[model samples]
Target: MNNEISDDNSDMIISDSDSNSEESIEDLNWIQTFLEKPGNQIFVEIHMQYLTDRFNLVGLNKYCSEKMSTMLKLMTDDIDFLRGEYSSMSSIEKRMLDKECAKLYGLIHARYILTYQGQYDMMTLYSENIFGKCPRSACTGTPLLPMGLYDVPEQDSFKLYCPCCEDVYRPAHITQGLELFSGFNGSVLSEYKRYQQAFDYPVEKHLTLRDSELPLGKNLDSEGDDLNIINQVLKFNPNIDGAYFGTTFPHFFLMQYPNVVSGEEKPKQRFIPAIYNFDLHYNSQILRYQELKRQQLEEKLSKEYDPKLIKTKSKKIFTSKTKMYT
Candidate 1:
């Protein structure tokens, strides 16, 4: 089965490359350039929406919080161990301790993903407070020109840069924190500079398969096509990165798999929307938005509306007053 799967994947890649090769270079170039744009607002909006999507936001927050807690626990364990071993350590062992400390710093530097219902909105607020606008300025003379969507650091709320002018800026509080963390030592600053260089790189793009080619089920039709299942497996398998599949004779046959339930029936691959749509993070965001809206509406009505106005008729009261005056 493994041999068959490998052959199928190889064939698929070849077929995709051959088919996609005919695609216009101009279109590809435009896409690449658009992605390259600093502070590409559209991409930022899309990312914000994806982060704050009803199902993904909650899941992401929970996942991040749990990871943070786990990391803290591990750090505590490491510190305890280090304290026990510190006094008797030789020079080589002390060097190992330095390596351990560096590892800890790296772990701390790992990007933290925070999901919020109003992530896009929050980004705007942060931009307004720090850089004056969320959109990158097109003016070459403007300091904001260099600041793009990618310039925004994950987890850090205060640090920002102008992509156009290559100017770095941070909120006062954030600067204070950075000062405390660095203790005027150049090591943290050097690490941050390296991180910025890495963070500026383009996001990796993955090959997306169409619905018809997605393999998610265990059923085949009369003609016997297992291409969908093969494709789905390939998509989920992170190991297949930078690999291509070919579409030749024996390679096509690699997609055909025997049905386990009833040997006589070939199972067709079915698309599963549930797998992709089941983002816990997004669902939590939707719930949070609903709650927020509800609260806002309630507050508005309570403060702005008069209950007495509903009970009394202005026209009838005016008529009564007129009669008394007459």
Candidate 2:
């Protein structure tokens, strides 16, 4: 009876161990494969915690936008079965979810890094020189702080900044480039300063183009405005290589319309595909062939004389010819 009880206990312990291992694997499946690294464990937990709590997010639709529903479902899986399902999903779908997850995490992490808790965790990494050391021999192996060139996300990657040197240095690891960072560019008061900030105080260099000088067209009262812009363009670009400066600016037909503001250049929409620089050689060749065919047709039509009297000799001497034949 004592042996049977010991055997039963051992069997239960083995079963529990197997179950725990399965659960760990399932949990790992929920996160991105790259994120499963032991070094990234803390960050992955923080990201999931933030994602689990919707209150931390503002404009939840903005980051993932169209993928919000799917992303949310994929992100919020806490159960073993739900987490296990992640591996079974299609590769395209998995990649798409992973992308949105990364974007969402990045957005939150940007804000999270500013928090004391987040900074404390990051500071630990900082001390270890995980972000990389300043390359300059002046400060040998000085751990660099991750700072963004622009506070705006996606505009640029986080660069390692050397406090000792006050210059940007390449990160020791490429993964450090993905770390959350805020730049001094957002405001002089922002947590960090630009790499150039310490060396030279930034002097604002805004050019105030004389708006009074660049009128789109001549005034109704006088043709006074016509020469102003031409003079200005010549004043600026005095030297030219190929073409002599034409008095007239290249004006689009849209500029003459009352609805279109000629002063402000219309912005291209971000969503719209701009084909301005796209190679349209094949399309142009097709159009050229069609144009030639049209020109030929027009030339033929133009050459034909209109309504020249063609007197039909229907009352011909056909009678004489018929009689001779008979």
How well does each candidate superpose onto the true structure, as a TM-score?
Answer: 0.18, 0.39
- Please list the residue runs of candidate 2 whose C-alpha ends up more than 4 Å from where it truly belongs after superposition: 1-25, 29-34, 37-44, 47-49, 80-89, 172-326
lDDT, each prediction: 0.30, 0.40
Residue 46 local lDDT, model 1: 27
The Cα error of candidate 2 at residue 217, in Å, is 72
Model 2 collision count? 0
Candidate 2 global CA lDDT score: 0.40
Using TM-score, give the best candidate's number: 2
Error of 2 at 227 (Å): 69
Give the per-residue lDDT of model 1 (tens digit) for 1-326.
22122433322221222222234433322223322322221122224234223443232223232333333322333444333444355655443333332222222222111223223333442333322221223322221211212211121222234333334443111111121223333442343343234334232222122323447752223222333222222222211211011112111122231121132222222222345567466666776676688679867776556666644657678889999999
Instruction: State candidate 1's TM-score.
Output: 0.18
State the displacement of the C-alpha of residue 247, model 1, in Å, after optimal TM-score superposition: 33
